[model samples]
Target: MKAASYDAYAPDNSRLRVGDVPDPRVGPGQVLVEVRAAGVNPVDWKVMAGGLDPIVEAVFPVIPGWDVAGVVAAVGVDTPEFEPGDEVISYARMPIIRHGTFAELVAVPAEFLARRPVALDWAAAGGLPLTGLTALRLLNRLEVTAGDVLLVYGAAGGVGSIAVQLGRERGARVIGTASPRNHDFVRGLGAEPVAYGEGQADRVRDLAPGGVTAVADCVGGQLDTTLAVLAFGGRHASIADPSVTEHGGSSVWTRPDGAALTELAALADQGVLTVEVSRTFPLEEVAAAFDASRTGHTRGKIILTP
Candidate 1:
């Protein structure tokens, strides 16, 4: 099996290389996916540099990726939920990082696999899992509902874009923060766009004078602005900033749930949700893909095809 792997930690892409590795073994309650596309995320490189050291330990020569869309090649015992040739997508993060989606094949737990949405191509499906799940979790935690005013930070980025759409679908008036260049893009996602930075709080106040009912922070380090703009008794959560907890906000993290992924797929098939793919790279160009993700300016997803 060919994969992009690194022997040890390096903050940059200097250690990433494409090469042949031993094939993964299918264990009970697992399924083997023939990799078609893998999504590049900030966490991939961050994990390579020991960003998740305190939470999840990495094994040496790690293959870096979590989001995958592909066809099942085989199924392990007790895994009647999937069969060979079934197209699937998964946020395949495990406690250990030895095996990953950035390979010719990855063995994912059966509970992590969901049928891919018919509406999305391989690239879009590949990019949907992690970010979509993150947004879904954030919105769920915030209890966003009809008549609510929701503010999403980093609205044009992968998770933020999905959050904006989901918020709108739930009948909330969504206000999204992005750069001037992405204001139109954010608006297209069904959110009012406000440029983030100095005076961002004032800008959001102009849209929702009573303060937003909910805040979902996809980009971090804006706790002060979030506090300033959130309505009294409002709910708030941050995926990147834990300091939000001290200010009566929650720190949220995404988890793998095949059932939730299936619901997301249904939304896509119904034309209520869609993924935006910014770029696609070949397996050999993993380094370049990571470089693009590091820019932190991508409007949507950066994907890698195997």
Candidate 2:
């Protein structure tokens, strides 16, 4: 199996290489997924750049992607939730300490594997897990509903894109923030698009009129703007900041839940939700995929096709 990995935190690329490796072997409470595709998340670069530990402790020489989607090539002992050849998608644990889906195989704790919707292809299913889980958690925090006015920051980005659709599915009058280029795209996802940047707060204010009952800030370094766009004391959550009006530390981040992943998969199967992956790169280009994730303004998810 070909795999790409980095050891120690330094700005050198020599250690990041694509090469053959023994297939992943499952242990009790774990399952081996024959990798088809993996999602390149911001956390991937954060781990490589020595920045991901704050969420969860990091392990060295790490296989660093957080999203996985593939077939269950082998099931761990005593695991009854899945079987061989099961099509699955999952948000691997934060910090994602073990080998990930960047190779031809990954060993995952069964708790992380969620059934992939049969209607979605491997790439589309792979594009989901992490972003969908994040979106589900954020929207849950926002308490979004049809009667509410929902505001989504970074609407064209991965999690934001899913939030737009999911928030709409929850019946909220969705107002999504995006650049002029993504306005039509955001609108097509069933949300009103508010151009982001400069006077983005004013744009949200105009779109939502009186106020926004809930807001999901997917953008970092823009908390002030996000807060300003929210209705007074209205529900607001951010996957990046994790800090609120009075809280501190990283305790506020949304905790991953397999149940939530299941709900998201149901949504995908039902056509009530969707996620877009902008590009797919192979394991050989792991470094470049991280570069793309770090670029900060992509329209959808970036995937690793192993």
Candidate 3:
């Protein structure tokens, strides 16, 4: 099998390369997926750069990716939930970084695999798992509900865009912050668009005079801004910053849950949720894909087709 791998932690990605590797082993309660597509996220490069080393230890010749959409090639012992030929999507992040989805095949635990939404194509499904799970977890952590006004920072990006839509589906009035060029794009996701920097809190206040009932910070470095516009006793969560907990907000980290992914998939099938894939690269072009994600300007998800 061919995979993108790095033998050492190199922030500049100098050691990252695509080459032939042995096929992944299907352990008990796991399934080997014939990789169709994979999602390129910030964490992919971050892991390669050793940014997550304090938490997730890396082994040499590590394959680096977490999001995948693929077909089950073989099922391991006791894994009765799925069989060969089943289409699935998974946030396949493991406790250690030895194997990942940026390869021709990946072994995913059955507990992490969910049926891919039929409404989404390969690239979209590949991109949906991690970002979708993050947005869902953040909204759940904030306890967003009907009649509440929810404000989302970085609303045009992957997690934020999905968060905006999910907020609207939950009957919350969502106001999303993005650049001027993406205002309409955010609006299309059912959020009232506000420009991100400078006086963003004021703009949010104008939209919801009582202040926002909940805040979801997908982008970091905005805790003060989030506090300024939050209604009294309101809840907030951040995926980017841990310091949010000091301000009475929760720092959310997405976990792999097949059940939650199943619900999200149903929402997509019902037309209540959609994934926007900004660009896609072939597996061999993983480096270019990482470069694009590093730009931090893409309006939606970037995908790697295997």
Over the stretch 109-131, how does candidate 1's per-residue lDDT look in tens digits? 99998999999999999999999
Note the clash tally of each candidate: 0, 1, 0
Give the per-residue lDDT digits (tens) of candidate 3, residues 95-127. 888899999999999999899999999999999
lDDT of 2 by residue, 246-295 (tens): 53212135455678888889988898877787899888888888778778
Off by over 4 Å in 3: none
After superposition, the stretches of candidate 2 with alpha carbons farther than 4 Å from their true spots are 11-14, 94-96, 247-254
Model 1 ranges with Cα > 4 A deviation: none
lDDT of each structure?
0.95, 0.79, 0.94
Of 2 and 3, which scores higher on lDDT? Answer: 3
Quote model 3's TM-score.
Answer: 0.99
Clashing pairs in 3: none
Candidate numbers, best lDDT first, in rank order: 1, 3, 2
Residue 8 error, candidate 2, Å: 1.0
Which candidate comes out best when scored by lDDT? 1
